[model samples]
Target: MTRRTSTSIGFVAVLLWALLALFTVGTAPVPPFLLNALTFALGGALGVSWVTATGGWHKLHAVPLRVYLFGTIGLFGYHALYFSALRLAPPAEASLIAYLWPLLIVLFSGLLPGERLGPLHILGACIAFSGAALIVAPGPDGFTGGIGLILAGLCALTWSGYSVLSRRLGAIPTESVAVFCLATAVLSLPAHLIFETTYWPAAPAGWLAIVGLGLGPVGLAFYVWDIGMKNGDIQLLGASSYAAPLFSTLILIVAGLADPRPSLLLAAALIAGGAGLAALGSARAQRRLIK
Candidate 1:
């Protein structure tokens, strides 16, 4: 199959895995600190081991320490913010808002020396923002649509910066960068102890939750996203990523963390619907080029 088809499939797989991760998080009574640290540590060990087994780890030490610092510290903030938003906001709303990452990337692309936004890029920004608004329209009880909007906006900004910086790293080995992200995220481990708890449930069920996160969402999901995103169209990347939110919210419904509230469901439809349009546009353009 073509790269785009493969990527669409990969994106869907990642979303399903992410949904499982969300359910794990929802069910676990663990504090966020302990949960997030163990979460990254498990994923980090797996990623590092996977790369090392195949000699890919050798490329890592050659990378400047700065790369690790940037990858670790920068990504820590992004993931932290992303997760916090889910804790504080509705799943679907958080996903819709977080997706502004691609639009931010396009905007940053325009500001960067050689990066520039085109008509399609501008179109994407507008569509995505509208979807976000629909998803997070203000509510009360501090679950204010406003709060969700803010948190989601933060995730998008941080992730967008991560994307731009990663692109700037040029042809750096993808696996090496992944190592830096997972390995160095350890810097945030201390925060688990200082700012929050460091231990998870001493139960089989808790361990299982950690495993799903580390292996699936944390380790495997990143690999899929990196492979799909780096090798596929950016707009298609944005559109395809909508799958993650939809799948995640669905999982939340099954877990009862979120009601199948009409607003949340409709908002999800907007994001998914917009994604379909963009994906269709990209496909038609590709077919025309081949023709």
Candidate 2:
């Protein structure tokens, strides 16, 4: 594929990632551990089944055990820290802080062999983060300082670290994501059994939420993101990623899951502008490199 086409596809795929917020709907009715476990379990099963039926199941065995180990630790750690923080802090606050991974990814990309750390990337990250902060800024009773904040920071770290490593390991079969998800399910099952009550989604809405989470955000998004980050323009993807939270908030408001807040408009401007600036800067740099 042409570089331009690939970049456009990656950009669109990452934007669609905003659908990930659908995972939030499931969280209201399901315990975090159970929600995570079930989502991964069901989704992973489908992935495995598809690969097997298509004669690609050997691809799973071909993946290095180390990737499985790292994927488990990284993804599970992200889930544990991020969800636990939600219980301790306001969900908005926790989410805002945790979503810092995009900026972190931009910064971390510099460490990868071919990725360059440009000033525009840094500036755009700051602007995007400012917007994120504005949107999740606390109401009168929302901000409680403690472990939640620390956990949120760690969540960002683990994810940023994971993304970089995933890119470096991009040679691994994409089917490895199924194994990664299954590992998460197996690891999370004990926590679900011990600390949480296991109950399936009962109402139609609840069931819908769970199934949606399993199929979309928690499942397929991972596959798309893996390839996008590995081959697409990393800085552009990082800058554009700010849109995920924005998209989530807008969708929530539209769905009546969240009340509308005035800050969203300003947040939209800052994030969109930052993403645009970063993307433009990257394009100019590529043109210069070609020249």
Backbone clashes in model 2, listed as residue pairs: none
User: Residue 97: error of model 2 in Å?
Assistant: 3.1
Candidate 1: misplaced stretches above 4 Å?
A: 1-13, 102-124, 140-149, 197-199, 202-204, 284-291
Runs off by more than 4 Å, candidate 2: 1-16, 85-93, 135-139, 142-150, 199-202
RMSD of 1: 3.5
lDDT of 2 by residue, 102-126 (tens): 7788788888887787778778877
**Clash-forming residue pairs, model 1:** 139-145
Residues 41-95, candidate 1, lDDT per residue (tens digit)?
A: 7767777777878889667667877777776765577666666666666565676
Cα lDDT computed for each candidate against the true fold: 0.62, 0.71
Best by lDDT: 2
Model 2: ten consecutive residues of lowest lDDT: 17-26
What range of 10 consecutive residues in model 1 has the weakest lDDT sum?
18-27
Whole-model lDDT, model 2: 0.71
